[model samples]
Target: MLCVTDRMKLIHTKGTQGIRGHTILFVVIGLLITETSTQAANSTDEELLNLKLRLNTWKNRYRVLCNKYSELAANSSAPVINCTGCPDGWFQVGDQCFLLTRDVRVDWQASKKKCAEIGSHLAILTSKEQHEALENERMRTRVAYTDFWIGLTDVENEGDWKWVDNSMLKTPFWNTLKSEPDNNQSGGEEGEDCAVVDSKSQSWYDVPCSFLYHRVCQMDAIPLQ
Candidate 1:
């Protein structure tokens, strides 16, 4: 599989004008090698044909996915992606790709910017199922105790919470034990505006946006057609 950068380079290179023919030639060579190996293993011709057909079908699907990605990248600030599924570090969960930042701990605003730099937004979970899926992935991490900054915030209006997409919070999984979104302003000059999901408690809490914490970035994962 080609890396995102390599795919972008191939698409832009003038010398790659005959990429279609080159790609077809490579596929044919690969198929021939497979056919030879299958024959050596005493495989039937019909089985070989079926395998080739499956490969061809997948190849066509890959091309279509690549073309769609190119169009999206060209039209917007989306990251240049050639293949489908999640990126290298991202985990897939029900058509969405999520990345839990492990090494870096930054303020909520900085975390949001970092996610945007990679062509993804802060994690905006809409349903309990999605949230649970992400939480399960988070639990699998070595540093499962650390809290993660989500896309939720009450920046504009103090009590009116909204996700990164500007959608109002509907089905909140707030930690009632903590009495969260209490907008605690004991030590800080600003009120608690950003939301963070506590890994230990398994619930959300509103904290000062300036507080340093790990972040979760999310984006749509292209489905294999």
Candidate 2:
């Protein structure tokens, strides 16, 4: 009876030892699985963080581009302004300046257009003073070769000689022999009823206005101050 009881006790001790080893192994496996899962989760989080950082970088670049576009768009629209320069040589008229070129060979109308382009009119001898001014200019320049054009024409009515500026010829300064036209006398061999200044001799001439010649234009020096 004593031998049987010792054997049974040994069996129970062995079974308990085997059960404890199995429990320890199961605990180690559980710990390894938990560590692997945690490591995967940490890696996924790091990858997500990097992706978010990249997205933010792209967003910043987009914002910068938008700002630059807005600035350029704002600056594109503006108004153009007009500016004028002083005309070449003559003297200042009322509000413009003038320049009389050395006598050029152009027709009467061409001469007038040339002067107008430079912001003035042909030498409109409006007053005796203005006529004297022309005579003086001719004397000073010593350009007395032939007749030159002045601001005079009879475009509308025959015999009604008028300044190219359309002002009436109230004053007279005939060179002794010739005079204003006797009739409208539409342009004939005399071109048009235009004026010319004989640059060499400094005498005025009533040539056909259509004849081409060099002429003068006037400008306003400053505002009529």
Candidate 3:
């Protein structure tokens, strides 16, 4: 596992299933290094093209990490690395920030609290563009919601489902060919307020705010220099 950290004092958290996650990253890095070191050996254009692509990807990943590191390190003693790559837990969402927390189900309020405890917030889809970005990042098919929690609800009004961030939910989307819970039936009834982005193919689903969901959290990405 690559357990490099800025401060030796900072305890090593279990970094990304490192032994496994890093296998792919390291293989790619090694390929580029070997290719560059052996450049005079007459490499194939195919190998060179692959190297260029991989290097470009790493550079882009580094840029994203640098931005994130900047924000988290600001106004603190937090030191930043020149380029070790993106933090283990996070995945990139276009220029946004994302982390795959797996299937941890928690109630709306509790989920939000947990996200903060981890230095983040429950996933907040503030716009259609962001929603599209998230789908692309996750490939939208592998994960499950079991009705996961999202940053939206009518804590203010009974029927009005708005994003917790107060961002407009202008884009209508849903799973199971259903738009949303009408809030009329009484199975997992009232006060159960929270939203779930379902189908991994459509917009998302908003049920009672109280239903526990396999949730994901998102945080503000560090700004680019």
Candidate 4:
């Protein structure tokens, strides 16, 4: 039979092992809880990101629909061309109104006057975006392979170009390949001082202001109240 001291020792050892097992079990449970919390946080972050993307898409769609509605409303008023956004025949792009004419061909001066009569001016392309828009319009209308007048000229001073709005022409969009703005006279007393959109390249070229051609007009788009 075992002694009393031996029995006490055995009980103590078993008790220690039981305490160790419980400690290990508690550690594993804690680790599992931490892992679950981290996974839940990551899932929440992904969901939030998805929501933001969807919101942006919906906003863009709403803007397009609003513009379409505005266009339809403008068309409803037939006789009176009171365009609150863009006129019936005009295109609205980036807060501006553009009108491309194919039928009316006239000199640069006459074209400018006509645009003024319609409460607009010859188009002054200040950026590549405007230039691309004009190009697209030209293609859409399928204007003849001929020059079209724009609002740019070096009339005041030689080699010093300016727009009809008195804005100085900073970025030159002339066709370099053709060596444009050559100020060619083509057997005329007045050398080329006006700007024209070359039919071939859709780039600006200096031509005589007296030359007759179709013109593009632009004005600010009236915002809806």
Provide TM-scores for the models.
Answer: 0.60, 0.47, 0.53, 0.60
* Runs of candidate 4 exceeding 4 Å displacement: 1-84
Q: What is the C-alpha RMSD of each candidate to the true structure, in Å?
A: 21.3, 32.3, 21.3, 16.9
Residue pairs with clashing backbones, model 1:
none
Q: What overall lDDT, based on C-alpha atoms, would model 3 receive against the true structure?
A: 0.64
Which of candidates 2 and 4 is the stronger one according to TM-score?
4
Better of 2 and 4 by lDDT: 4
- Once superposed on the true structure, which residue ranges of model 1 sit more than 4 Å away at CA? 1-84
TM-score of 4: 0.60
Structure candidate 4, residue pairs in collision: none
Per residue, candidate 3 scores C-alpha lDDT tens digits across 1-225 of 435554433433335456666898899999998988787555676688899999889878877877787778886899754433234556655445666567556678888788788787777665667665556555655554324567777767776667756765565565545635555446454643456775255366556655666666787655434
Report the number of backbone clashes for model 1: 0
Error of 1 at 56 (Å): 14
Residue-level lDDT of model 1, residues 76-146, one tens digit each, is: 99887645578777887767888888866899999999999999999987666766766677777666555
| Model 1 lDDT, residue 15, Cα | 57
| Sort order, lDDT high to low | 1, 4, 3, 2
